[model samples]
Target: MKRGVRESIAVSAVLLAALFILPLLVIVPFRSELLTREPPMDETEGEPFVSGDLDSRTVLKVKNGDTVEEMDLGTYLVGVVRAEMPASFAEEALRAQAVAARTYTIYKLQTGGNHGSEADICTDSTCCQAYISEERARANWRKNANDYEKKVENAVTATDGETILYGGVPILAVFHSSSAGLTRAAGQVWLNDLPYLQAVDSPEEGDTIPNYYSRAEFTAAEFKEKMLAAFPEADFSGPVDRWLKNAVTDSAGSVETVEVGGVTVKGTQVRAALALRSACFEWEVQGEKLVFYVTGYGHGVGLSQYGANQMAADGADYKEILTHYYTGVTVEPYSFALPG
Candidate 1:
């Protein structure tokens, strides 16, 4: 080959490589997939995915409404961290959230996921982790937009490629906003009794959390209507005080079971029916209404965001916070990597 020809080919190759690399450099980590609601598929994997292995190049398929979003692991996690944790939280707490979000996504991928082969997870908070677009986060932060965005990005990057594992496998790393003084055991909130998700003390209380304690009042007639819709056999014939009876709760103050009317109902069932903030609640009948005194928010399971922040403030690192919330789990980096 002539020298000029070889030189010309090398220059073109370099330019082509630069073209691809430059875009990635300038592009922001934020991305949002706009899709209609996805049609239901056979969710064989009830919750998470299988095979706890991944590399830097791994891509996650996230179900957003009706469309599937494909993005690199790092990029997807940045959006997840921003949506899942408040950037105003301590840096360590944000990092803990970042690791939890990362572990959750990987668990979904390893467990084969539910959205068929098309997706490994979903954007719906009720289903999987919550994720948001850059614009939405910016709008929510307003004046603190730039700072908050950087905080989340740093949190994610700081813990890049890390995960919480149990028995060398990626656990279902579930988390919530707060707990009622204690996190619920896996068997208490889920079918399986995962050792790592044992009930543990949470540090945050009413003083730390704005809505640590809440109330939901329903008139006697309204209460009966809603209760009957869920528990048709519920007996609401007696006095308002007798409507809730035989309340059973755990040491952590999590209401386990209660008798509503004549039907025995789980606390979770009651929470869903009444739209209460947490399962840890007690009710009082005053006048013609029943007021439920609720404590904490979310499902009262797994890691508590507020608790984590408190721990961070107390001088605990991200790993320590995670280890405390998710018992017997190690915060470790993934072993698998792509060959250079």
Candidate 2:
């Protein structure tokens, strides 16, 4: 059977959305196809294709509609999938559609403007990459986007009610997507009352942290000396040498909670502050400066899409891809389909 694709226009900026994946609690069974083989594409259906030339819509300037709308790049991406992708990607698309359907369903039932319009979708920094040349996105489009549309369309059509209850309240529906560009390693999904439902570069991609692009290099000694320089009167131990030997440790107890300028903070945060203070004395070679350069983007707790793509490219099936990061979760039919 063929499935349909669904999409929503995003109004928010993409960079603003650091983390879009919502955490799990809903018992929706992940279809094996969601993490397995994608459904077959229907060559017969006449779907629109993006040629190497310019897309007409891209040139359309933003104008004020009857009601202003705002959305994240994630929502726009989902819309692109629905408008351009195929059923193969649609029926089994992961992450994006799940969030989008939930968001759309929520919004359909809610009134007022608790959520912004689709004008706010941003596509800057790590939040989103420039649209790939048609040549590059084609392969990707074939493998992933097409099928995702089907899945979203199905979910949207299948909703028994117009709105979904998230965190106990009904809100508008809008999905989000991204490389998770830059942020601390905690996955939160409040844009629509969801958490890391679609995290890419999750922890299962092995021990290597997905560096935004290197490593944290500030020496503990250098960090401490800078801290001492910042707070000369505070009773800090001996020179940088002594502090390096016993200051910071992975152990929770090693963290000393202290009040600084009327604000109490954890040892790690304090250590981080010292590192930043020291960094000010260093050089800004490429982009961000850090004592320790962490790799990848987003929290390392769920699935890593980049890793999954690499795996997929290397011939790893979707199930293998899903299992590699999602820990232990079953992928079965939810018996739900989008209503016509």
Candidate 3:
């Protein structure tokens, strides 16, 4: 009750009040603003952004053609899963798509996006990832629209900020509609050989997948024209059957090196030039026409949508499905931070 004791009590009271009130004043405003501002990407350093302190509600700049739109990361992911994978797919498959799509978006944002300073990502499935408005997705779903919308929304919410990571880094997470029994390797499909994007066994096959097996027929003259368009130096003047020769196939039966008109060309190039469903194809002279018996769809790299659905049907969870297709990887809540 003396003067010194009263002064100590007064100091303690002030310290306690400051501890509780100071944090709210400092944190509340920054957290709210995090939803609208661009991710702090330091361009001069030429390094991926990394930050330990970040609000959970991340923002993304989406490039929809010429104009750019900004929205919550979760909202952006829901649109991507809705556009990239069918709502009819199993819930686990949808969840896998959600995580993969999120990783792709984050990776692009951190690793010098293709759009430069304009955007973090784009809506084009070919360039970035497909994204459609909820109204349009509902219109496409029709009768089961509400259920489908809820399913996609649930998938994104359930996975939240999860992402597929390889070596503690968010990967490219490239995916396709389907695969040719087995998914293709990164080096086989693209220039870089990512360790996690190697070829792996995929379960989706047969008639269950659309265009699992298809044929593209061209007359000898038509085949020559298409081949010449890509391989201008190649000679297609020979017996129709002989023109397509020396096809070196991968273990999955996808063409690795195929001799087109005696000129060795990559199977991927043939798929591009002929507009085939996939690189896993073989050509033969069926009567007067050159027929290419193609299998599966897309570039056959990374996650396979139909394949993921098949795995989900077999009782695998989202984590299991993603890891299976992506080789050595882990599914965990992503550290939504810009790499420094």
* Count of clashes in candidate 2: 71
lDDT of 2 by residue, 187-256 (tens): 2222222342433342223233233333445454445466556554444354433332223222112233
Model 1, residue 206: what's the lDDT? 65
* TM-scores vs. true structure, each candidate: 0.80, 0.33, 0.80
RMSD of each: 16.4, 24.7, 19.0
Count of clashing residue pairs in every prediction? 12, 71, 6
Look at candidate 3 and tell me the lDDT of residue 218: 94
Who is ahead in TM-score, 1 or 2? 1
Over 1-340, each residue of candidate 1 has an lDDT whose tens digit, in order, gives 6999999999999999999988876653432322444667434312221222343467667788899887667777877888888889999999999899888878877766777766778888887889997678878998887778778777877787788999888888999889878889878765678889889998985676888889899999999999999999888878898998898998878788899888888888899999999899988889889999999898877899999999999999999999999989898887532222
- Candidate number with the higher lDDT (2 or 3): 3
Task: Name the best candidate (by lDDT).
Answer: 3
List per-prediction Cα lDDT, in the order shown: 0.83, 0.34, 0.85
lDDT ranking of the models: 3, 1, 2
- Encode model 3's per-residue lDDT on 122-153: one tens digit a residue: 89977888999887987899877777887888
